[model samples]
Target: MDPQLPAWRIAPEDDVAVALKPLETGETCLGVALRQPIPAGHKFALNALAEGSEVRRYRAPIGIATRPIAPGEHVHGHNLRTALSGELAYRFAAVAKATPVRDKGHRFDGYVRADGGVGTRNELWILPTVGCVGRLGERLAREAERRAGEALASGAIDGVHAFNHPFGCSQLGADLDGTAAVLAALAQNPNAGGVLLLGLGCESNQIDALMARIPADRHARIRAVRAQSEHDEFEAGLRAIGDLLAAMARDRRQPVPLSALRLGVKCGGSDAMSGLTANPLIGRMADAVTQAGGSAILTEIPEMFGAEKLLLERCENEDVFDRLTAMVNGFKRYFLAHGEPVSENPSPGNIAGGITTLEEKSLGAVQKGGVATVADVIGYGERTTRGGLTILEAPGNDAVSTTALAAAGATVTLFSTGRGTPLGSPVPTVKIASNAALATAKRNWIDFDAGTVLTDGIDAASDALLARIVAIASGERTRNETNDERAIGIWKRGVTL
Candidate 1:
């Protein structure tokens, strides 16, 4: 690489190259003089282009030129428009092969659940069946934690937390079902050694109905109480949580293989370097875990528009391919149903960070899945059954998608961001920064810096990240966990009655 070239050409066929740093109008890079000043993380034309021509990034058509562009001219939303539209026919031309499982003897200390799942944390989780009782759950958790201070100090339990949300009531049909399903899955999350299900007696999301969804084997570790049935809801909740804390105290971490891991790969507050650095680094980790017989889930379905074909070809079989297709088209129809365009994405933050269109953002975002064959396609709030790369159906909202990943049974989530965010899921969310600058600037939010790929290279970064993940799985708290930045958001798609 030329030291003077402060830009990166992701692919030889790419018509634009990303500026690694600000370039003045007189400065020259890659033998091309700048037509205008280019901001860091933004793109510049590598070759002259005419109006209406295709603009390529990552060797894929990201958008179309709205007007004539000169060589080395800064390219952005002003002159570029997304070419994405309605769904098109897809064919399965398998490109990815089955990954070979290699046992490297890698292991992490985790809690072994009775259902054969492994938990990275041993905490008591208090889940509320209705939004009305969310505060009660929160109070119960605090009371339990305050009363069990000795247990917490003794390493008998990690902590007590109440995951509060606002959708259990005034919901009907799919909306109510979705709320119930997500709460049920969270209640069963392995990270929670024991669970207290607190409910308001009369609500659309009844505790009895939610309990039916949970597997029988997890019943021993879960306790349920209806507030309206109790003389004093707060006191009853506290007692229930106390019992859960006692049960959780008996849980301990044990060694488990990498195959037992379920990882969630995601990106948010992305920038130009996101695809170049952090995302791909997470992809390497995904490939490593999948190849070791573990599972990895890739969501943010709408972001997969321009690059859905690439993922389609990676489907393991016709069924999975069809499922993937349905998922994509289904989400597209959802956008249309709401009278919205399908390609309406690349949030304002993304544009300022050098991402011009959803296609460009997606081509980079999909890097989180690496090149592994997709083993399954799951709906919202569903758990992963088969190990490998699985695509989930969800929108591009960061908190919502991250929460879905956890509800779907991801023991840990690897979130790549160029612009930093303090957002986290119920599980440990490891934030990987795309550039060293963001990592340094937001030390509290960033967990790992993938920008080192430009200096130390990807292999070193991947190794370091893998080690960090193992440590996290072994109970080393991520910034989010330590800072108590945990929350959940359910995907609501129906009318509120």
Candidate 2:
């Protein structure tokens, strides 16, 4: 980490060093002069690479060299190809657990819910059961906001939002079920102190059916309206919002243990520095949260292609291991079922940002889970009932996975990006920039500069990150919240009727 050095070898055994800055042909890294210009965040060979030999980064094979590469030569998609293939059977290897630190842990101010869950924000949410009534739900929310301006200014409730999706109607079987599951899960999120479920009675996803999906105990906090059946749908929706707000007016924040915290760790728009900086830094925060007897949810199943073993080996038990194994394979099957290769990843942006293969991207991506033992693997839109690291089943898309995280009860989500993205989830999303340049350039979108870890080190950076998370939990708005970039994306995997 010498300030004078412009390249970083992530591990002592790594065959490549990531360019810390743009370098010319004459610049030396690892005692090898660059053979070509290397962009910042790009990788360069530290030693001669033989054709068909494995190339390593993060001390693991990222891909196979397509041709012989001289030392200091740029390593990229042109010469490196992913070695990933079809999924294989996995055996469970139990990892030792860290003793819970609940005897002493961090605390945050949150709203305690009737179900014993804690809310990072006492916000009111409107969920439309069908797309037909989606705009109606928005109108209701806006009217509610207009009427509650005084209470909003007084912090009676956090800002209100209507989460509307397009596939509630004509979605059959699993697709319809998926829609209902995420919406129900959203209602269950403690962040939604009050919820208004607006529905058009004629839709396939009826208010009655969706209501049945929710727990009976949570019914009191969530009010529903059948827009088609009501004589005046708008008035009925407004009345429902008023009723929910009345109940929330008495809600307040109280000190809660970290065990009450459920964190969702995600990364998008990643670069080489993502692994070296942001992801590992978030990993520190993940381990800290789990060590304190809290919960951390990790998703983006496809990204786990080459590096899933990092999690499989850490499963708390054989059952957890088996479930995670199934989850990974199922996703691969999903890709193949659609005539797509499981190895098709590390998007164009990823390549431009120095990631050459799905394997390399995954190795970096999974770092966000830190080193915590896998406690459980939950299905998409399911809540994290376990109190350590839980893996949720979801895709690698930023929108879909972050929505799954929030639906799974993540009061706050930690999103790391190196290429930069303004996307935010239903919950408060704290964006950590992988490099200082992106952080500086997108101040409005970036929350923390994890790039500092390259200079300041991870220990301090992680502690600072956890503190920032606690503050965010205590009602401090994230960059996403301040910029109003919050939204939800339901996973639509089934056929439309």
Candidate 3:
């Protein structure tokens, strides 16, 4: 056993201690001797727990022990049961205030768009307004890439890719509005120097309607082509987009302050180690960014089921709290409408990785928020204004949640995983691994390792994570982004065309 191992007990009422590493049965740690062998990335009871005693983490009750658990013995599915449903306590003023954190005066090298928004990478985008024009957008993007390479040789543009999708048409209500909002937001994204909008003339979502909401100055960088207006002329659309891409290639990156950044932090393929290390370490990074007066967005509201109360307490006011609570309840209602209880959540992979209940998963999910005050709450595709730490309502599906975050204007994203995932998004995503073995095995995919927090001293682990986030945000090439390889997926709750 490493003598320098650090232990983290998220709650004062926690019954278990997360072992930073593998501990032998007789190893002594922090003056407390291990009563049984504990594996790295697993839990060990810190004190004897009577049957039915609550198990806590993140300072919140996660579940109850089905039987007595001796100190140092593993506390998992075999001995733990899902927490009983009850009214949650929301005591903002009652909880002790945390120590204030200061910013280190750091900033990322990014593109300062004309509108004061900062972009980590500059690219030309092509968007399809409806499924009917998906192929048109794809062709245009391919054409732009082919033509832009001559100037790309001069480093005029990073890359040109058409973001083609199939759900812009045949939608209604919030769904139709959401599709339009995502495309409009993408067009306005600072990362995009230029945008080409391809629309089928008869689609439910029209370019003119979307442009009405967006400012002309920003829309000036965009060119729109309606396939029907041009008699379904794919070649004409490609030529028009090609001309725009040439003009956009001239845009360049400029030095910017940290405050110009809006980031999205999330986790997927989660396991036990996630809550123990990478999640909290990223939480530290989230705190640093928020302290710098930058924005950090935490989404995947479904993944936040049992942990809503923790977020409510941190909300700046009642409105933000109400918005967040309503979103949580909405998800529950949505799931219940389908005749499924929200309690039977967490994918099979999550349980196999040692998370036994949704309560446990929710506790771990909130760690990505760090200790920051919940500044505000926003809905899907809503512009983020009140900055600090804001929560967005969206599902836990990797693509869907990431899509919503990117649409809300996150310039960069921190995606953590334990069982390992290959998903990526349009924004620059820095993949943080939950354990060292996965980080080493998939270095080609993962950008950083949060497992170090469990292996090395906590401070060292956190500092390492901070450094990596800083580097990635500064236009440095993360392992995934460097290859120009990405995992583009969307979480579709409605029917697909």
Candidate 4:
């Protein structure tokens, strides 16, 4: 997009151009004079469109015209509707593997764990087994912070945090399975030098079950407490923390290859500029890391709807393509089973930001994955076992999805936003604003301004972003960390019995 222009068309085949700024009635753009006012970030037809004609953006169908749209008229939700209905079938049509960027030997100062994984931050984590003991975990974390104040001041560890989610109890089957799986994965994150597995004894998400889910090798670094069984749970937790901190004090940062790094790509509160700027900018960064032999994970399954084919075709093999196909249709079935339309997306906020349909949102959202070959299809809460691009099964909720990314082994997340938000992930979330206005308005929240891409161009913007991510991996605090915006959200599905 050219900020210098009054309006910009994203692709050659696009039938509409998004207003670079609010366009008044009778303004001339794209060889057509505007018939009505168009809000900046909103779209205007490039040519006449008959009812039911496909609306193209990013060289793909975003939706179809619900009614006749005259040239230069506003193209938005009022005139457009999603063409998607339900599950889709995908045939494996392999695309050439995208070449990785030239390896420049990118490295970051990180803590090397006994398991050979490197950590961007060495922190103590307190995880509650069930919602019943959530506050207990928080209290333990606070007291530990006070006890470890000197060590914290001396940088022995990053910080102590308690991730308390309200589902472990009264949950059955898959619900309990997901809760335990995520808790176990979080404990195993290289960032958590030590973990306090706090539990309320009588929950379906039992401490024993969670412990079993965690690898035996990781148990040495984890301290589990049955709050109900302990005489003084707080004191028990404090003692456990004391022991863990003492052991972690020996951990120190050392230079490691970029291959040890895992990057998670995400976007939230998107607007029209998201696809044009922030997302593609993040894509370049993802490609850089992957090219250097590092790993990258992309989630938000619902947002992959219309763009599934783009990702599916890039799969490394028939197995991956088949798995991805199942995952996509399964998510769509999840919506239908709940009696909701699959295209019931583009939240009011998305619509206000000029997104007309789920197709438009998905097309923009997948740009974060770049052109990397699809390495694998990972289940919810499962960690990425190999490097390259892994597609994770997750919803589009800001917190839940990002938390899933962190659990899936992302040490740092490059989060893109157009509408802007203060939400952060368990890992450091580097917020990239889609426009200059947003970056300026949320200076404290935004870590990078991809809006520069409008003038500076993508290659220049991407170079800066990759450098910023490397610095973050080397222990530089992101805006999210400095603002104390770190949080975790667990997805709740299945019955609560």
Better of 1 and 3 by lDDT: 1
In TM-score terms, which candidate is top? 4
TM-score per prediction, in order, is 0.98, 0.98, 0.90, 0.98
Q: What C-alpha lDDT do the candidate models reach, one value each?
A: 0.89, 0.90, 0.76, 0.90
Q: Look at candidate 2 and tell me the lDDT of residue 257.
A: 90
Over 4 Å off, model 2: 96-104
Tell me the tens digit of each residue's lDDT in model 2 across 23-100.
999887789999999999999999899999999998899999999999999999899999988878987765866534
In candidate 3, which residue pairs get closer than 3 Å at backbone N, Cα or C atoms, i.e. clash?
Answer: 400-491
Worst 10 residues of 1 by lDDT: 94-103
Instruction: Residues 397-493, candidate 4: write the lDDT tens digits.
Output: 9999999999999999999988999998888999999999999998999999998999888878977887888899999999989998878999999
List the candidate numbers ranked by lDDT, top first. Answer: 4, 2, 1, 3
* Residue 169 in candidate 4, Cα distance off native in Å: 0.9
Residue 209 of model 4, lDDT score: 78
2 or 4, greater by TM-score: 4
> Residue by residue across 248-276, what tens digits does model 3's lDDT show?
66677666667778888999999888987
With candidate 3 superimposed using the best TM-score fit, by how many Å does residue 162's alpha carbon deviate from the native? 2.2
